[model samples]
Target chain A: MTPKMNSVGVIGLGSMGYGVATSCIAAGLETYGSDIRPEVCARLIAEGAADASTSPAAFAGRLDAVILLVVSAAQCEEALFGEDGLAPKLRPGVPVVISATIAPADSRRLGARLAGMGLPMLDAPVSGGSIKAGKGQLTVMAAGAPETFDAVAPLLDAMAEKVYRTGTQIGDGAMVKTVHQLLAGVHIAVAAEAMALAARAGIPLELMYDVVTHSAGNSWMFADRMQHVLDGDYTPRSAVDIFVKDLGLVNATGDSLSFPLPLARKAYELFAKASEQGFGKLDDSAVIMNYVGSELPGTRDN
Target chain B: MTPKMNSVGVIGLGSMGYGVATSCIAAGLETYGSDIRPEVCARLIAEGAADASTSPAAFAGRLDAVILLVVSAAQCEEALFGEDGLAPKLRPGVPVVISATIAPADSRRLGARLAGMGLPMLDAPVSGGSIKAGKGQLTVMAAGAPETFDAVAPLLDAMAEKVYRTGTQIGDGAMVKTVHQLLAGVHIAVAAEAMALAARAGIPLELMYDVVTHSAGNSWMFADRMQHVLDGDYTPRSAVDIFVKDLGLVNATGDSLSFPLPLARKAYELFAKASEQGFGKLDDSAVIMNYVGSELPGTRDN
Candidate 1:
């Protein structure tokens, strides 16, 4: 049977959301975009989005599916259940895909609230960063009822290179994504830690990077993010504040389960420290600054 | 010019050492094997080693190169400079390759002592573990004098698939290797932490493993060691104590430089905790037990 998700409304015209909207349009779907930012909304409309209204409620009843690519569970909640919420206005049984990385409990609570309004919800979180999102090559970890998945198959196909079905339970995708953030954050922090130690010991940052990328010390984060450290660039490709939030969610999840996550806690603190030190708007690789002080390579007046 | 390293000796016959010995033999070197364990030495003798004496001093004067694959800097020192040491007996100017994971200070100290004895030294530490060691495919990070590396080129070629010339200073290789250990040890511990978090969240371990291996969360250690966690097989491919020691060296290196390594310190503590919990001899992935306690998957009796 053909998927019912023909027209899609993506809330939050941020990097990830705008990419999803454009990708959906590129895939021949009737895609609408909504954001508080008028300029970004106009950009999406220029990129072939059917509408770029700042509120999903403008066409909530006409959309076949809604995807929340907002920053947090709070924004997601505001978009779906607030005074001008789209959930009540949506067509009955239309799927709402929550693509933000949030606590599993928040995802489940959102899904439950959507269900009460005769809406199906998918807890779908995307990875591979904004660059991948723009290429329609994000990796999505999603969970929901089989029917919910079937309903949004077309939108998922349009936005992701790979979609992992975590389980039928709505929160399983968030659970997996939270655990994933634990690794991703810790890997990025430790990659910075390793490079910082190498720099202090007088090894050339470029040589250490080459050795590490070739050695068992290699990680996806180390290979991808350390380049920023080497280039002395901290332009917020994925800002330090993002990990501060993501890793905080990780530790919060562990706390909710009464499970201790030491590494995740440590990584969270490092990211938080980076953010507090005014590098929050810089690339997450700027977490290296937490260890390197002002002696970070490629920044010297050589 | 023909390389002077024709005959070679390997001290320490544990898994890594035995593999190094065999790889040398496989490459047509006249290899001598030494170990505290007689049976391992006998096995190397059967595997075509020219001699399998329990002491390198037996053939020290005749050997052109010696590789110490011992466990620690202390052991390396004892094997080279102890009462029955091999250093003074070795021919003048022969290259001594120290492959142990040690503090850069210890590596430098050893190189200095060897230099005083009219011997050139290469601070070369290896990675890729025993299985790769057996196949002559290990990666070696090395530093030394130009002549020292040239002298040991043939022996290095025999034992390693890749030999990174880190720099000319003796401890540079050890420093690079120590920084590498920070990443390797932390990645393994964090992999365990991530998997343990997934297990506690009721996500299937195998599925989490698959998702992580394919995602940006992937690390060489996570991809390699998480398998042991999935199979519930704590069969000591690389024991927990290895990290306890390696990460300990990582922190000590940081200490020597007055550089703080927070993640490495945390990872070292986790591995140490695993060791104290009697999982010391189990696979390094058993660091998961520090998080999972008795609820570890595959080990729960249905």
Candidate 2:
């Protein structure tokens, strides 16, 4: 079905946001892009995105739907409902799709504020990483009022392979997303630990990677990120800082809700220590090296 | 090529052993089968396996090759080099393949013992679980003498998708399998902790599973086993004791090697706690419900 919602605004043009904006245009949405960085905004405009104001409010009155691709719950609140927010600029019944992975309480509060402003807010958090975002194959966890889902359906389809209607409550999407982060973080940590242990035991890291990939020990994290270890390239596809944000959201929600998450908490501690080791800007997989310490089985030659 | 090595003896007629024995027979070998249980031997005999003595030695002298599929390293050692053992009974050169997942040092010791008897021993551990075993699509990690590889080629073809040759040393396969266990155990633990957090936080477990399975949080473990959680049926396909054994292997190797293995140790602790809590025979997925006394979500209805 053709998307009835035409004008699309994707805020926060970071790696994920840029990929999403590219997908929006590729999917034939009349896409507008903005970010905190002027260079990024100019690049998006050069790539055929409409040169839009950084303010989420700029597309409000004209847009049938707006997608908040910003980082953190605070940014989402500010962009949608804080001073000079999009909620005040939108038509009475327009839809707002919040796509940041955030705490459930933040989603519920922001969604309630938008609803009070006569805006239909869909609490949507996306998955599948940046590559999938660029391909428009992202999975979205979303919950909203009935009309909100229908109103934003077009934009959701243009950008996602699946949209889970988790519950009627706004926080359900963010809650599920938090759960996703918990597993993702833990799996990455475990993959690093296993790889390091193997390497320390005198198994060549490259051979260990190959053997483990074919064995039962394999995980998506190992499959996707082990190459970085073999090559000794810690270049950031997903930065270590990303986990700092993700695990923070996890611990925050876990603490507030009293959820028992000791393993997840322990994994976050490792990632935090790795970040503190000055690997924060590198890829998250670099955390393996931190755990392994010196005397690494040298990386593959470039 | 058709196997020139005609007479092949397969010990241990359990799931994996039966599958390997069937594959050997299909490959045109004169296959003999033996297990502790007489009923299993009777079943193998009815299925075309030649009736064999409970003696690994009897088959050792008659057969070109012998495959040991016992449960533990001790059982493998007992079957191969016990006082009344196949190593002494073999005609000084018949190759023996050990296909049980075991400790590397144990495999090394067994290899040394076999060498003294002038018999070649291949430390060959397998993956792909029981169902894959039945289909002969298992992964085989093998290490031993070069001639041993030549002798085992026909039987290997009958039972594996891939054969990873670690090195010309018996402990190679066990070392690689230990690496596999580390990854597998951690993945299961991560899945358990994530799913439990979701349940405790009031997110629907089915929806949580679906979203995480499709997202970056996904691993082979989550995709394969979360359904049992959704179905609330924890029947032991791969029992809890399996992880207790596998993770213990991982930690044992890591500790002996002085490798820092926080995640591997944590994984073993979780499985050990679950086994202690009485889910010992349930599917390994039952480890997800092990945070019992902490009183977060308690246990799901399954």
Question: What C-alpha lDDT do the candidate models reach, one value each?
Answer: 0.90, 0.80
lDDT of 2 at B247: 87
Cα error, candidate 2, residue B174 (Å): 0.8
List residue ranges in candidate 2 displaced over 4 A: A1-4, A56-59, A81-84, A294-302, B1-4, B292-302
TM-score of 1: 0.98
Model 1 error, position B232 (Å): 0.7
Candidate 1 local lDDT, B22-102, one digit each (tens): 999999999998999888888899989999888777788879899999999999989999998999898888889999999
Model 1: what is its DockQ?
Answer: 0.89
lDDT of 2 by residue, B1-302 (tens): 32467788898877899888887777677888878887888777777776655665555667888888888988887777667666677776778898988899888988888888887888999988778777778899888878789887878888888998887867988998898888888888778788877777778887887787777788888888777777767878788898899889888887788777888788788899888988788899888867545332324353
The per-candidate TM-score of the B chain, in the order shown, comes to: 0.97, 0.93
